[model samples]
Target: MSSNLPKNFPGRPASAPTPSEVPAPAPSAALPKNFTPEMARAAAALQAGAATAAGQAPSSGAAAAEQPAAQARGQAAMPGGPEVTRGEIADHFAQRIVRMVDAHRGDSSRPRLYAIEFPFTDFEFDVAYALAGRLGATLSASDAAVDDDEPARPLVMLDRVLNNPQQFERIVRHINHGQDVQLVCTRAWQLPQSVADLVDATLTIPRFDAPRFAAACVDFYELGAPPALGADADWVPNVVPRDFLLNSQVARSDIVSAVRQSVERRLRRYATDDALDLADLAGMDEAHDWARALIDEVALARSGAISWDDVGGRVILLGARGVGKTTLARAIARAAHLRYVEASASDWAPPQNEPQLGWMRMNAAFQEAMAAAPALFFVDDVDAFSIAPWAGMLPAFLEQLKGLSADDRVVLIAGAQSAEHVRFELHRRGALETTLTMPAPNSQALAKMYSVLLRGSGSTLAQADLEHIGLLSLGMTGHEVELIVRRALRRARKDGGRDVSKEDLAQAIIEQRVGPESQDRRRLMAADELRNTAYHEAGHAILELMRTRGARLRYASIIPRENGSLGFVLPGVDESRNSVTRNDIVEMVRVALAGRAAEEVFSGPEGTTSGCSNDLQQATAYLRYLMTRSGFHGLLSLDRSFEDSPELRERAESMLQAEYAHVLGLLQRHRPLLDSVAKLLIERQEVSGDELTRVVDAYRSSHPLV
Candidate 1:
């Protein structure tokens, strides 16, 4: 081996060889005069291998030299290697010389020579121009000389004609031949296969600084740096230290184990931690008070510096739409000083690279925290994360979480609309450790929510208005309450006052209606519809009063409202345990037909309203149930088939026909009640139960029972 190579040469010996030790070239040698002894040795080995493969013994040194010479000449005549067109040769040689200069001068210095192929393609020109500009070098067309006087700088070939592979191989061969070349093949698509094979390195536009490039390199190579580095002016062997590599692998394994531990610890923590107090998020005083107590219990347990034990377990907050699940989850994270990582179900993707890398990242985040205390990984919209495409990945994620050791001290809090949905997905996988259901705001909470919203807007609302809003928003969530309040506030502001009136709140409530109310309202005209609804309800009340004279009429309104009703009448009655009677069924039928009768009498025969659709359906079903299921029909001789029997059916039909006629007659006779109720509805747009009762009592006193 050569001993006294340049210091820049890597893996070379420091000392020169003695003269006697240096072997002279053999007489049989036929290699290029400039070929190094090492190159000659490599060539000799190749020749020997060729000879053995041909079933012949190793050739003599002289014979081997002759054989390679003949082979090279034969290869030169073959059309296999890179084709060297006149234009390609110039471009290749030029690029070779430029690379030689760049290699020798270092990155900071510009190469002395630059040769560019003429009429460059867009890709070629862009690359060449960028390189020349970067090095502060000049670009010259093919056939152009660098200088007539001094030695020209190496030419850089920007071959725009050769295909990708041809250009790539040509560049590689020139470098192997010891030519200083840097080829830029702009016509890469022309020789895709060849380019794909020989291009060892690629330089994308926008060269970055060392730090970015280093990070990018690490990511691309999927490898880490050595634990230590040695100071040197020249390139060193730079093999990764065996100890460091081994330590990193151990550390990675430890991290994976720690992550598994943390998940388990989190589940246990949430189980014991006090339930989340969501009063502030709820924004209702009563709810706040109630939630505060629960929050305080957790706070007490977590008091005086949080430790692994203080950390809560994984909590899945489940609720309907517009509930405060997300809000509560965030609040918990903020209060507990836990790092929240929010991920939607949709955000979960199939795991790539390794099955455990995602878990590893998550684990790494909390591994350090375990030594100090515990942290929370709040995953939001967890249901979305469990979609079918991500099912395979989800099990691994959940399994990794389940496998987490207790020592890791991390909590997992998930938020979803339905705990059942998540439970269904994870129950089999055993993902859910604890499920907390968030109920909609209660009446008191609803009132308090309205008050809070009003107070924030510097407005004063009467207790009556608050009560009304509360009653209307009974089944609504905290978010719905907030939305209702916000809408009311906006109305108040637009009306040029901070005070929200009862009418304003009611209007806001109507405007914010969802579901059926949000549908088109053009099914029936308003006035005719209101009148019909009032008459129909009046008929029912009047008939009920006639059948059960003691039954008191509480209230009736013909106001067009959401949820597909034109009017409604709630009859006042004493709370009792009494079941239904035949008389009650007949009276109910009369009340149901009151609106249609009133329409027929007041709005004429042509007057009809779509409002009766729901009423008709309900009344028919009730009558049918009573006659058949309740055994109220007189046809005792009939079995279940009585409903299909002509005689039994005829009897039920006659009874219903009479009841319908009676209902219409009652509505027609109590025209005074109809007029009064309609007038009130038009004026108030909404009549309370008390108001309806008072009106009904007045009408009954004036006109007597039908």
Candidate 2:
């Protein structure tokens, strides 16, 4: 074996043979005269197998090679060692090449071309090199010139062509100029469109596994015996260690150990040392199932029981920030026992004056993830990575993304606030095609979270109180609920370490959502102003109850919020209703304007305070939507620009006037009910939905409308 051979040379020695010896060439020798004895030995073993199958006898020198050659042949015939073995990817390519040769024998009608694609492993090109040697083909990376005496051999290009336009053009030129050369492309994502146009057929190789690894080792090294393959030997990542392994003087017995150590050094550690399990993720039923399925499939893939394509590990989690997308990704990594690598898209974005930096950062991140095979590669805020096709870094970014998608060892999980704004190309095949939307936890989900939090805290809240707290925390994320629970627990601790009460949780929710109540404002405001604020909120609540198509009122309060609001009336949307009609729009407008109408009903039109300004703005917005977008006034959907027209302006004024008059008349007719609710609001400062409902129902029963 020669030490001067290229590291990627077919049958390059893993460890050098003694300098004192000259090796014998076997009967199967078919390599060119200048080839190293080591390559000749490997090629001989493969060729002898083919020759023996065809009933050829060995030469005298081949008799000297008989024992070892037969052992090599037997190794190739078995399930796991050497390049020419059945079921090995190299064997499949060999058969394909043989078929192509037979099909094109002595024919000069077309360019003899064969292309195949495979997800690249570290030693994939070596497979091509061995195949080329066995079949008398030319390697693109080989320096040896083909002998002018022999017939031209097929040109095998296992190296990447997409990134090298010059080499691609040369290949295209050779084909177009009627050269008598055959082209074989062993590695491709897909042939470049121009090359695809000329290709007659394309084939794909199966994914890499333990058997593939064993075959690759035999081709690259002179192992004393088949490399010992553990159950998870395939879990070792294929990276750049082949260069070092080929250059070093590692013993045959130590070769697999050295490679495993290199993989261990390259592997990443989980970012969070202590990640939560799937059971810890409450209120995310769909997300739980998604993560669990991934965990199971990943386990199967790691054990070589299935391929990563079967796992389908690339996915994007769509949700608002803090909706637990990151948490879910980490949990999946933990559950599957895979290396966890997380990077934010913003982290990869280029800084000032460095447009190419973004792609470089993204490429580095991908490299790190690939080094750590069986890894969870998470990109947070992936929506930020979205860029226009014309952007300077888009090509490089996509190229790096293409590499990540092609590799099966790294499970890619990306998070985005929404998918609508993400780059359309990012959603193309082999990228973030699988989208999982994580919605904010609803009331029932919130209840489950509260229950979990309470149990973890060693405190108990009555089931009814949990339900109430959950209802009050509607539309909140699990993160928000967690924080609110923490605040409530703190409140309980401050109050002599008692169990968290419903009031404590409710107060925490109020403080978090609306801001703390303004005790200073309550004390400083005039009595008359307080009365007016109460009545204004009361009016909104009353009209909300009266409107047939409006949202259900959650609560009404006269307590000033720290956000500079004198009062607020919270309403919850009915999730069951998927669509709204014209009348529903009118009803919403009436609710928006009810406070102004009530202020005028109590304090004459001139006496109404500026408190109705916000109410008027809300009413105007809803009315604008109704008049323009909803086609409330005419058949045509007019824009707000038409508000300048005299006819449209008059129509808008009449609509507002009529809606206001209608609400005022109702406030007048329901005067007793409005006053009662206002009195209750003034007494309680905040009124619950049940309390307001009771007042309204009592009033309606006593004063039936005609």
Candidate 3:
């Protein structure tokens, strides 16, 4: 049967109705439909008093005003009398016990009784049951007849009628009539003024006992005993006896042995050669040798018995997305013969009575796994766990790590996108141990990944194709490489096992490439932008060539490709040349402005492209460098900080404005060359460096740079 129940004390027997229930107290009938301003103020005051009694904040105005008038009426009806609802009764008893305890503070010799009160609702019942189980107490319904044989454990009343003030009054009367029991309640209801007067001085529930409440629920539901609480004998594994694998020189073999035993116990089933071959299980063999080596190293380390103090307790495999952090973690678990438990940080939350039941279960599992020792607790995507200020039990989670001992065989491996964040959190908690970063797969690694996929599918991929795949997968990680190979296999399967062709691979690469369909469009726009950029670069190249005969323009072209550069000009110059003259700097500025000038003269100002954002930034920085560091500004000779000076900044801006104007006029005079070059680019879409050099040479033959 579902363990659902309401959160309140059972109502009084119908046959013997109390005065609070019969003759309908007259004050309730006279209560207002809505609280008057004065009444609202009074209710707020009462709510505050009640909250203070419960050690919580008062409800807001809307909530305070909406409470059933029956609460206030019940209080008014029992100014000094004996009538009240089950809720008020629970509050009254709780208050009395609190008062007794307060009056007897520091007098432990006095009779001690603890009462827990909750509404009999399903959530409250679960909480009560959990608390009872944790406290090792027996729980009975409020109406269950108590026999002499029943253990006299502390009583917790689950009263459903605690919200009804009339019913609560009778409960208080029952308690007052010499029932030697502590009182507790789940819901907050108005307490009588007399009861409120004594609350602060009398009753309190300690915050540390919250977990006990959680444990109670777990036990009440028979969720099964937490693994931490299970008998140690139950954890023993059926494995063949083996000698202690240890380095005799290491004094910490005892510690290592404990951890090894713990790990072996949990993973006894996977302690075979076949089980160690997880690479094959994962359909990967290109890196089979590497995988085998890693396994062998782990096995050797396990056998060699390094001292516990020298051995690292935790291993972190850090890498960019999809580099097999999880895969490595699983392999480690298999290698160590430990149970692998995977959980995400996003899956945990602060314990709540109802909603947090699942988190409690997880907590139980975590503790159980830890107690089992020598286990691999793989926490995946741990970066997603949130920390909030109001979370009361957050420290408990962190405390679990703090409590780990050298004897504990628990090895926690957490995965995240960035090691920095995880390291920061661990450092803040002082829990970090050892870390290992996984690098992006190199070309050889990519080739291996490809070969593995191909061999697994019984298809052969050529070495040239593998090289091409490696080149294309430059920045990819192990996981991404595997995924790409898997995708290729899927494609091969779709084509009926036909040999995967270069065309098929190219198609896949294009599909995987960013902005595939937009490639042509982007290229077109980039080419237009490049045409203008080429003219600008040509202006600089021509100016330099004229000023310094040795400054030869080797090649210039407008071609659009990845990295967003539209046009480039390569000057055949010494690679070691770093410093340039003032004239050279001026020519560079002229080149920077050439594209803008060419667009204005040939394609009109409307033809200017947004692709010049980078160019403009580069040109501005160069101009500033000249003014500040290179001392190219004719009148202003200052340090690098000169760019920040208003005078130098204005002069630099003016110089660039004048240079751009001059370049624009020069482009207008040479409009035919600009048009011819642009036409060639539009026709061919792309031009080789040689083709561009020929075009420039022809233009210069007719119109010299000078």
* Candidate 2 Cα outliers beyond 4 Å, as residue runs: 1-276, 279-288, 371-373, 387-391, 405-408, 519-522, 631-635, 639-646
- Predicted candidate 1 versus true structure: per-residue lDDT over 1-706, tens digit per residue: 3444433332233442322201111212244423333444334444455567689796554333223222332333223221211212222223333465455557643222122222122234333433332232233223222233321222234543232334444445444544334445422222235544544333222212234333322322233542222232111111111101121223432422332344344434333143333444543343344334434444544453444433445556777767776666556555654434445544555365443334333333333233223345556666764456555446545654564444444566677786545736564434666667777766566777677666656666777768666666556677766677777777888877657776666556555553223244445556655555555565554554455633454344544556656556555443342477776776677666665666677777677666667667667766676777666765453334434677756766687678777766766777777677666665664565556667777777777875
Ranking by lDDT: 2, 1, 3
For residues 554-639, what per-residue lDDT tens digits would candidate 2 score against the true structure?
Answer: 78888888788888887765656768888887877788888887777777788678888888778777777777777556788866
Q: Candidate 2: which pairs clash? A: none
lDDT of 3 by residue, 543-622 (tens): 44444523344444454435455555544442235578887777777777776676677568887767556656767777
Best by lDDT: 2
What's each prediction's TM-score? 0.46, 0.61, 0.43
* Candidate topping TM-score: 2
Candidate 2: TM-score?
0.61
What value of lDDT does candidate 2 attain over all alpha carbons? 0.65
